[model samples]
Target: MEINTFRESNQFTYSWHAIGAGLLASFVGFASTFTLIVQALINAGATQQQAATGLMAVSIAMGLAGILLSFKYRMPVSVAWSTPGAALLLGLGVVKGGFSTTTGALIMAAFMLTLAGLWKPLSRAINKIPSGIANAMLAGIILNLCVAPVHALAAYPLYIAPVLIVWLIMLKIKRMLAIPAAAITTLAVIYFTAKVGNIHAGDIMPHFILVKPEFTFSGFISIAVPLFIVTMASQNIPGMAVLSVNGYKPDAAPLFTSTGVSSLFAAPFGGPAIGLAAITAAICAGEEAGADPGKRYWAGIVCGVAYLFYGLAAGAATRFISISPPVLIEAVAGLALMGALGNSLMNALSDKENRDATVITFLITIGGHAFFGIGGAFWGLVAGLAMTFFLRQRQLKAA
Candidate 1:
């Protein structure tokens, strides 16, 4: 009887561990990127109300998706709005067509994602996209944002130094915690230094706003295509790999389909894109969540619940970001994305044979050199692929 009681007690501990892990995962995920999401939306031409609504919608979508996947699969299958996708938006900046057009682009991208799940050929084609080119494009998209710290340091050293210093300290101790630590530090900086006019009661709770989408060829090619590519290459594919590594391999089709479908629901509300997570998913699926792998679903469920709460409280986050000095929030965001940029550069330049093509892609993207209304991301991929094909043909002729 004592042995049995001990087993039950042990199981109880594991359950709580899962719960705690889930909350941490959700908090980290939200705090780390919520500001970026808002910034990206505003850059894409969303008004403050629309940007905050986008955050709320995406946060809720992420929560609901996590809950659905975890409960059904009995695993810690975490979901998140695409960080890289948001970065792509930031890189693209305000398109010619405006926020409604960006919304249309997002809806189209979500549709393509859903199709990728349902259609085997499309999925295979997307998966087969050269890692070097894809990574190079991602590296290019985020390259500028990654450098925001240097500029921010020069501009607001007094206010930003403490945040960067604390982030640096945490980076050595706990890499994952570093960004959130920076975010918290920024909150402190904002609270004490910045003059944010009175945050009314309504400012603490975000309200949903419907966005009417307008689709155009320019928006579709510039925003939708690149958004889908990054979300798939950087987030969705790696997200599945993370779960597989953690010994929880659910069907990728459902993951894609569900997130894509969920994104459709959120896009009208200005959500950029949604997909499975790469980093935070590992947290919820790892053994740290629970010893019993089967019970790790609790972590996912709790993470989802926490996301719902964050969604409701998104207005306060937006309020702080709004009052922040220009380049200040980007500084926090840049610090947060350093790790991703590092990984992307490593992957993009890893292959000696592909270095030439990869460099073309990276330079064009990072340079933000565009052609005829299209953005650098679209042109970078094109130029990279062309260079890759031409070089391969030359090699074949020589051989």
Candidate 2:
């Protein structure tokens, strides 16, 4: 009776704190990367309309997935579209089959992810992939975009200056605000100098556009496989780690299944894979969310609600990117991904015994070559595995 009374007494306080945490997490996550999502889709042959559709689709998919997972498990399990996966798309030169082909790839990848949840063996095999190779593949995928700020500075000094200055200042004040601040700064620069062009009523309101999926071998090897590997290795697994670090122990498979299913539904409308969130997971699951860990599920729920609102802003985000200088947004993306690149490189190089193979993987992936319709990402993984295997075999023989 006393415990129940105490719980009722603190419910209001808990609710407000959780709501605040959720809003903060959603704002930071969405503001920091929505441009990346829009620009990447366009880079991969999406028309502005298709890109906007994709943004809305992904935001809604992830938002719903986060809400469902949090409520069902009673844990703070925030969901997000794969950032590394988007980076990989940016690296992919326009595929032959265009956005519809990319849509087909999305379906296949999401299917595999959903299957992994249902089939233990597949999940274990995916888990068996070495972290170094996975991280290196990711680092390679993001390398070009991560260097865009330097290029932007060299090309458009006047335009890039305020964005970088604001980002650095925010970094000193509060790290969480840095990227979002830079994003906002970029918006101001766009407003004054570029003046977002040709924006209409349709551009301000989000809509659902059904893209016909086109299956091709190139699409499968280039888009589907790489997207699967990075989303699994970089986003989903690391998200689980963040939750674990926060002392939340929701079963991994169910969470994967739920997000995978959500991705499947969203793909025909141009969404990429939705998975567990790593950075935002930390925000929603952290102590700031609530005093009682058990009640933190409310944070995830609120984040999902917030993302649904962000989805409504998808058309506007697409318009901003369409008119703004490409290099400028790419610079913002580069800054946004600096932490990810550094983290991946650190992880890839940490395994001293595998360091050489890891380097090989990074070089091949960053080379961005294609052979027989297969892209550099797949070749890099293969080469890295071969190097690791040869080294291991030689060691066993010597011993």
Candidate 3:
């Protein structure tokens, strides 16, 4: 009887841990990308309801896919809404279309992603990108995400100061829980200082607002293609690289295949593109989650469950954020990403041979310069690679 009781207790404990990890992972992942979606929706002239639906759709699809994939591989594989896609949506799609046009572009992008998945050779070839370049790309992408908090602090010094202090304290005292500490500190300050009515009552509750997709060749060429390229090059490639570097070795096909199928499933419901999340995946993969590689799967599971709750309560969730001060969100997000940004910079600049090239990539990416309708990340990589090749040729000739 005692043995039976112990077994049941142990089982419950394991389940609880898995659920906790999934929730944490989901919050981190969602926090990373949801802002871009909100901005995209507003830019696209989506009604509040439509925007909520889009957010929920992406969350649901990503959560379900992450859960399914992680369980299948018995490794934590987290799926996320594409931050790059959201940026593209904000930049291009918003100007061209409202909800209907954006949906059309989403469907088209998903279809293309699906086709890429089906072409196994192509997927494998893309996956063969050099680790240093892959890391440089990721560093370029996250550079701004980390600095946005400091920028936010300049905007709202009174509110963010306390939160920043608390964050630093947590970082010193409880390293694994630093993010949660910073988040808690920000929320607490907001709750105590901000008026209740200001925090809660202004925004309308988000609701389901479906926008049927309308196929447009022009929209596909301009919006969908660029969005897909950004999502794959900036998001998926690094996500796969993180997994590979860690030695878990989930099949690239299934990962991409799942993202494409899930995005298609989410299109009508207003989801943005779904893909593997490199930044959040790094968080889960780190020693903070667990030293054991197998145990890290729990982190992805935790993220999935949190995403499920966030998706189901998208209406309430959006309302909550709508009322909260933007400074709070910005500060918290910046603090959460700081560690990640530091790691990326360290890795990108570590090699003497790659230092110059990586610096060029970092500058172009961080400078936010766009050329020929292409974003910083894409152009930054091209410039860096070109410099790298040029320098290599020079060295070889001299030798």
Candidate 4:
């Protein structure tokens, strides 16, 4: 897809569908998980203001990064907050040195990601990880979220059924619109069932609040290392897979470096972490975005613009989510991610040679256990690859 062709095609003829896809994907990605992010920040000892600032920073950073990458490469590249990283924070529940120290850890993670992008040996090592295991790790990370709708329906049948029904109908009629339909249905249910006025909107306006970094040995060991590992193994690897499956071949190092730079700037502002988006990027990269791949970059641009606006409203949005029942929001997010989870599982299991290893990775990750301050994702990769290596060696000996 040439830039000239993008320019010549009716001035890019702006595929509104592409733009819509981007907008929905971004909205779902943010709305569904922002409460968890806020909770993670607060649990890390951040004030509410600081948490909101973090959300704004990551939203803006990802938006701008997505736009720049899309325009520069003419690919539907999207960036996002690291969901797995946030989950890691949730599990940490206030590090030894508090929020400032955690911020330092985020900066360190960003620096490590930047190095991974710039250093050949590191990048090659990352690339050498079996795709099956990487995909499995991501799948395990998201599997819980994907099943939320069912749990929601079981618990709040009347409240959740309508949304689930809409999502299923949309999935049958128009696959790309399924999640959007579910989101709309969820909103409608909330409007009728819950008092709109009760929804909090504390300080609706967005404002920046910086939390200076305070590095510590504990922060680095517990927070920084795990964040970097989860971001790389769970987000970036699958993100690259999304692009590859969509028929775009991009150099991974630059993308990693760029997101690291964005995260570096965002860290001081309370952002947990940022990375290439795997699930939402798939939304923008798919056929629903557009028939012509050349023009698909417009989807990412529109998504970026949407994210910028979302950031501006982060304060209000976070407040509203805080007021809403957590289960409902998780259900919406789960619905949005079902497609992605299914795809990841398929990819993880597709390679027979790596099936055993991938399954090991998936089970360990889904187990959601941590040891020695390291998250399951890291351990999952280690276990899976070790099994894979051992099995390969055994096969060679037998042959």
Best by lDDT: 2
- Candidate 2, 185-272: lDDT as tens digits: 9999988887556677867788899999998888888888888888888888989998888777667888888888998988898888
Off by over 4 Å in 2: 1-14
- Per-residue lDDT of candidate 4, residues 203-317 (tens digit): 6678999998998776776677768876887788789889888888888889999998999989989897888988789989889798877778888998998989989987876
- Per-model C-alpha lDDT, please? 0.87, 0.87, 0.68, 0.80
Name the candidate, 2 or 4, with the larger lDDT value.
2
In angstroms, give how far residue 156 of model 4 lies from its true place: 3.2
Candidate 1 lDDT trough over 10 residues, lowest sum: 1-10
Q: List the residue pairs that clash in candidate 3.
A: 21-302, 22-301, 22-302, 22-303, 23-302, 26-303, 54-270
Q: How high is the lDDT of residue 127 in model 3? A: 54
- The regions of model 3 sitting more than 4 angstroms off are 1-16, 27-47, 83-109, 128-138, 188-206, 211-249, 267-270, 277-303, 324-328, 392-399
lDDT of 1 by residue, 194-264 (tens): 77667676776678899989998888888889899999999899998988887775778888999999899
Best by TM-score: 2
Q: How many collisions per candidate?
A: 0, 0, 7, 0
Against the true structure, what is each candidate's TM-score?
A: 0.95, 0.96, 0.74, 0.81
Clashes of 4: 0
User: How far in Å is the alpha carbon of 129 misplaced in model 4?
Assistant: 1.1
